[model samples]
Target chain A: MKTVIRSTTLADKLLFIALTTAAVAGIFYSREAMPKGSDVIIEVDGRTAYTLALDTDRVLSVPGPYGNTVVEIKGGRVRVKEAHCPNRLCEKQGWITRGAIVCLPNHIVISVGGKTENLPKGLDAVTG
Target chain B: MKAVKVLTVLLLLTATAVSCSNGPVEYRKTKPLMDTIVTITVVSESDRKADEAIESAFSVISRFSDKIDFFKHTSELSAVNRNAGIAAVTVSPETLGVIERALYIAKISGGAFDPTIGPEIRMWDFAKKVRPSDEEIRKNLPLVNYRDIVVDRSRSTVFLRKRGMLMDLGGIAKGYAADLALADLKKEGIAAGIVAAAGDIRAFGLKPGGEAWRVGIMNPRQKSKADELIATARLSNKAVSTSGDYERYFIENGRRYHHILDPKTGYPAAGCRSVTVISDDGIFADGFTTAVFVLGPEKGMRLVRDCGADALIIDRDGGVHTTPGLKKMVAFENGH
Candidate 1:
């Protein structure tokens, strides 16, 4: 009986140590694996029309009902380089490292960062 | 002793597993409607349910937009305009409700927000940067009056008293649409969501982790990236609408002419740069923002307080005025 009790104690301690290690590993893995500011996502008419890497330098021409809106991404920043809409307010918005640039007339949304469960930091929506 | 130790570990492990299974997943869908992008975000337990709810909400909003579009010749509001002084035009229940609400706001604001400003609005072309002559404004000013609108609730019809008077619902329709979409979402079993149409936004229920939705107000004079947001408000079960001169305007000879016309002057209101109103209902928030913009900061804040709503007004000289209840919720970017 004494020998059996010692072995049972050993098994319980082993199980406890194993579970603690697994929990710690999961926490580290989730933290490291999550991507931040991964890509520039441009949506046209409610669809993901373009997903460009933030590290690359590229200019994309997005077509809308009105005309094509030119988007330029460079040096970890993005902006609407030119727009065919009459207001040209999208072009005047300039560059942004985070948040979204919306062209209401053309129905285009250019945003930075990966889509997460929480709303984007600082700005979930902008009202003017 | 061994059983107790093993049971403790099993309980902790079960708790973590249960939490992971019940974690909320967010779904978002955006579409172009009412001349702006309408985005609906909902948190649900399953993707299929969220997709169906979002689709239904969008359909509801689309149907509402078709009825009240100011530019569409076949819209119900246009039908009422065409029949002005000729006869009453029967409209949908949704249209009647929105028109009734518009008249209420018009009365309370003392005609600062008149639905009959369509004739005056047509005079100025913001896209062409054309400023109408003072004589043209004077000719149209007489047609811009809220008293001219007549709604017969029993007959379910709308009539304008004057032959040339036109009813434009551009100010209040978007917010009403947002409210309708949210109601549809709730009917579909969505407990938490946000519906945003341009400057009109409505939020209900808590976000993930029980956090209130954070909404940022755009700076009227945003010259660069750093000045994007003037302030932010944490809101739940509330609606917010903002009217700004910078939204649709043209500058000629250092004079600015915006889309939100004053009924009395038949020209862009010059009192405030922007006005943001928060209320329990989206219709009031939307309609009152335009009314408050025309009323300026002092009178606007007073009217907002009277309506049991909150507001943040930015005057022409870059001064900020906020209602008492909203002072703590609004966090100014520059700590103003």
Candidate 2:
């Protein structure tokens, strides 16, 4: 009876180690596959005008109701380089790695990391 | 005995695998609507359901936009403006509902948040960078009174008592849109998500992992940096709106002029850099931000307390004043 009890205890210890190792490995792999900043999306008058890669550096002129607003993406960040709107609020809103740059008068919006899936889980939307 | 031990190990491994894959998946989409960016986020186990909810929410927003967009001549709001003082223009029930709410807030705020400030807004021409002459402003100031707006609930029509009294629903329209979008989502059986229109946001139900949604307030001083947050608030099942002087402003001759006008003075309201209000309704949150902003800190705090809402007002001197209830919910960022 003593020998049987010792064998059962040994089996329990081995099972515990095997389960924990597998769980840790699974968690590590999932974390490594998490999404990052991949795309920059620009919308004009609520319609998507551009979807470009973040790693690319370029400038594009987006025409709006008021006039043309220049959008610049550089070094994985995006911003409004110039705009014809009087206040220049969009241009003043500097580089954004995440979140959005909204030019209300011109009806243009530039969002970094286009989809919400690429962003963290807890943040649903940004408010002023 | 050996076979039973191996079975127990397999069962434990399978349980761990299930637990690891059980985290909620978040889905979000941004569409340009109502002259601003509208973002909707949903967390659920089913991707198909999230997509359906977002589609319905956007449709609701589009329907409201078609009714209230002041700039769009085809919109119902344009019809009302064109017939100002000539006749009562028939409108949809949605437009009637928003106008009624706007008038109610205008009465409560003593006309500080007037939807009839369209004539004045057009004169400023923020897009064109032109400031209207003082004479032009003086002539248009009298037309900026909310008391002049007449709403006929029985007929579902709206009328401006005076000619040239334009109804610009910029102040209150987004809130109404957010509220409607949230309602649409709920009807579609999506209980965990947020519907946000720029500065106006409405969050409902729990976030993933059963945590409250964390909302970051942008620092007015950090105008150039979009990610520089002044404070953060944890909330669930509520709406928040912020009106800041820094949002749309131009500097001329060392004087900074902003877009939020004081219906009384016909100039940009002073005393606060930004005012954020959180409440159960988006319309209230959006309208009150402008009202509290025009009222300044002392009067604003009084109104906030009376409404049973939470507020965080940043004065021009960079001092943060929050209501007692908001004090617990807000955590200031470093240097704030």
Candidate 3:
């Protein structure tokens, strides 16, 4: 009777150890599974002008108040190729795989990722 | 009996782990409004409640935008501009409140940030990539005086004493909208959040895990590198505003002319690459940034000191000046 009881306790302890390990692994996996953005959104004058896949390679001409701003996407990166805005600040913004390129004068903005994921974690908003 | 006790302990551990993993989540949303992107972020246990709170905040921002948008012909501000020098226009209480705050700043800044500078601002052609001739700027300078504005508190009316005197509200409107959005969020029982309109930002309460919000000040010289930070500040229940020559400007004959025009000279204010102000009031911070940028470092720091606000001013020569209080709060980035 004593041997039977000891064997049952050992079996239950093994099961408990397995369950705890699985639960800890599950928690880590969920955290790593957070979704990453696969698209880039371009807005002109506060309106969506284009939504391109990050895997695609293309050049897009977006018209704005100043003139046409040429945007290029290559190697999963997007940037302003050229701009008619006086400062050419948009063109100076070389390339972005993440984050945003904002041409305030042209009223153009290129954002990486989906709409909800545009802002990075821990940042509520960026001011200036 | 030992087996049963081990099973009970395992179940309790699992429960604790799951509960800790399901801690409060951060919800954030950004929408383009009022000529800039407005982002609101909140911490809540329920996603549905967070969505509702953000929506409420955005609605408040939209309402304020409608009241003060100068580009929109149907806006109450446009109505006021249309009736300038002809009749006193009755504005909404909110509009009156913003205008009143603007006038007060103008008074304190001594016309460094004048709302009636609209006529002068319209003279510059940033879209056309051209600078207005000095003669044209001179012709419109007389129309940019804040003293010419007349306000009737009882009637909530505003009038410009001279013809072509326009009220832009560009300097302070974003801050006012941010203030309103924060109030709306608080009303909706949001314990902590941030309301940011362009460069005007107001943070309230504490972030999840009791951490203060971290804000990065952009490197004004390196406009192309949007991720480059000149410095970072940790904030809670405060407002920060930055005015820089890089925002809107045209380079002509090797001169960079920006949008923050001086009311006295009718030209872009120079001497500082950027000016950042922090205070409890968003409107005051916004107005002071423009005012201090025009004032340069010495006088600007003096104004900041007098106003009892913290400031960081970057000069055209690549020097960084900070108030004693700000020196404690900011961490300068590499190569700053």
For candidate 2, lDDT tens digit of each residue in B1-336?
Answer: 564456557777887777668667667887767755688988877889999999999999998999898766789999999999899999999999999999998998888788888888777744335678888888899888988888889999899989889998889899989999999998998878988887699988888778877877878877433345788888798999999887666778877678888888788888899999999999999999999998899898888898899999998788889998897767887778
Where is model 3 chain B poorest over a 10-residue stretch in terms of lDDT? Answer: B221-230
Candidate 3 - CAPRI tier? acceptable
Query: Per-residue lDDT for A62 in model 2?
Result: 92
True lDDT of residue B174, candidate 3:
89
Candidate 2 ranges with C-alpha deviation above 4 Å:
A1-40, A43-59, A63-109, A112-122, B1-20, B223-227
TM-score of each: 0.77, 0.80, 0.78
- DockQ sort, best first: 2, 1, 3
What DockQ does every candidate get? 0.26, 0.30, 0.25
**Candidate order by decreasing lDDT:** 1, 2, 3
> Chain B alone: TM-score in each candidate?
0.93, 0.92, 0.93
Docking class of 2: acceptable
Task: Tell me what TM-score chain A of model 1 achieves.
Answer: 0.70
lDDT of 1 by residue, B133-158 (tens): 99999988888889989999999999
Interface RMSD of each: 6.8, 5.7, 6.6
Highest lDDT scorer: 1
Model 1 clash pairs are none
